[model samples]
Target: MNNTSTTTLTMKREFNVKPEKVFDAWLNPVTMKKWFFTLEGTNKVAQNDPKVGGSWEIVDHRQGVDYRAIGDYVEINSPEKIVFTFKMPQFSELEDTITVELKELGQGSEMTFTQLIHAENEEQWTDADIVKALDEMRDGTEHGWNLMFMGLKELVETGKVSYQG
Candidate 1:
């Protein structure tokens, strides 16, 4: 039998937009290409099938490397919640589940992004290398998500993704 544990990470953000708008941005291919996993000058290709059991993919071509993020929808409650499986095959074999919950607050929306990261193959819990790698992976995932959120904010609020003061 394999023994593994899951580490959960949750992040919250407030956006100056309606819950519907915020939720739709996640499934809209055009909007996703503009912000999701995209760098300033990189080309992004996004394809989203926004239904339960539907699959989605976003590929960012940057620095001559194509980084792909692909996933399948688990649950999608319009303007409320979304759950999907996330994976980046080139980087790691680890597949994680991400849940995004959105609620209307006043005239805007508040989003809670939760990610469940599963521990890899049967490794000793006391292994330093395993601990270190997990820590690094957690940190990197957080940083990447933050960057995407910033881009989302810029695009949803301004209809464009150029850096602003």
Candidate 2:
């Protein structure tokens, strides 16, 4: 059985860089290693194929375990928009879709990120339990994305990343 409910999380940020620069940072492996789904002191395996239908994987090798994130690109529009599906096989089977939209704002750019988090087995969980789980997931996901954005901002503005997990 499949539960089709989804919760959408939206976040927005402004960067002191052009849309093209900010957009490219997302797909570039070198830049991605500095921020995207990474933590301090972790060896990164970041690979990207920035095209519609292309797939990406980033594995962070920690002390005793490796955290792997895999995704496939659903849409891509240079300096404007990107849509992709995100999943962590080590965590759960639920896959989420994320959309990143960028627009020029004066001398810089603004990015709007939206994520559709799919609900888990509704049949096995109570409404309160589901709500709590979703709330936690939203909070954690937002924090992770915010950290990534901080790194991205630093990278685009200073050509370096200083944000540590």
Candidate 3:
């Protein structure tokens, strides 16, 4: 067995927002902050450029601690695909990259996300372990995306950019 634990995980949700708008939520910080956090109490500190070779990092401070994921965009196909690396202490032994793809579903959009996770060895590749990991990642991703979509739909439909709070 290989040391790399690459499970091509995917999830799809048809959102009530245009593919371009959904895509912009990812590229823009104002849109990203509304949904990207693991919890609402956390403060999201982010600076990113939504293009290939550009930086994308978010630091979430909650309670008295900080969690961060910093990486560079490997590629970007506007309103279609986004690929970048990921790392964190709270997530996993994450020396990997996650690629997010958006497909226009009629007037809305569907998102497909894949994460290439790195593990120490095959001993940690049990079905139970991997399933648990995938589940955590999947649920978190879907939840975050849902929040983002809702926030984005509100913004796009209302033509509001700045946060009231």
Candidate 4:
């Protein structure tokens, strides 16, 4: 039996930076380390090849726990859009597709980020339990992404990266 379920999370943010800069930051290892993964004692290894069929991996090590995110580039349109597959090795049951679209504003940019999360082997979850779990996951994911985006904005605006928590 194959049981799969999906949920999508979407977010939009405006940045006082050019679309190119914002797009490049997502693929740059140095910039990604500063904003994307800011956990203390977490060592990040980011390797990104932004092209169709190319792959990217980011490994964060904290307290002897390694959280690995591996993905492949499905589509890339410079300064405008990117689509990729995302997976966390530690949670093999969860897989997702992420897309980022950038629109040029007056002198800045607006980014729309979307993630479609797919879970396998979810047949065991009751309908009510699944709904609750997804709600909690969405809340937690939003909070985390908001913090990361804050760091990204700081880095792009002030050339400094600081995470409040």
**Which candidate achieves the best lDDT against the true structure?**
2
Query: Top TM-score: which candidate number?
Result: 2
Residues 66-146 of candidate 4 have per-residue lDDT tens digits of 788889999999989999988887777556899999999999999999988775636678887677777777777788789
Ranking by lDDT: 2, 1, 4, 3
Q: Write the per-residue lDDT of candidate 1 for residues 1-165, one digit (tens) a residue.
A: 555556777899999999998898888988888777765367467898999999999888876789998999999999899999998899767789999999999989999999998766454546675667667767888998898899898788888888421
Clashes in predicted model 1: 0
**Deviation of model 1 at 123, angstroms:** 4.6
The alpha-carbon root-mean-square deviation between model 1 and the true structure, to one decimal in Å, is 2.7
Between candidates 2 and 3, the one scoring higher on lDDT is 2
* lDDT assessment of candidate 2: 0.86
Q: How big is the positional error of residue 62 in model 4, measured in Å on the Cα after superposition?
A: 1.6
Over 4 Å off in model 2, which ranges?
1-4, 39-41, 122-124
Deviation in angstroms for 147 in model 2? 1.3
TM-score for each model: 0.88, 0.91, 0.70, 0.89
Tell me each candidate's RMSD, in Å, in order: 2.7, 1.8, 4.3, 2.1
**lDDT-best of 1 and 2:** 2
CA lDDT, candidate 4, residue 112: 99
> Which pairs clash in the backbone of model 2?
none
**Candidate 3: where are CA atoms >4 Å away?**
38-41, 89-93, 122-165
Q: Model 1's lDDT to the true fold?
A: 0.83
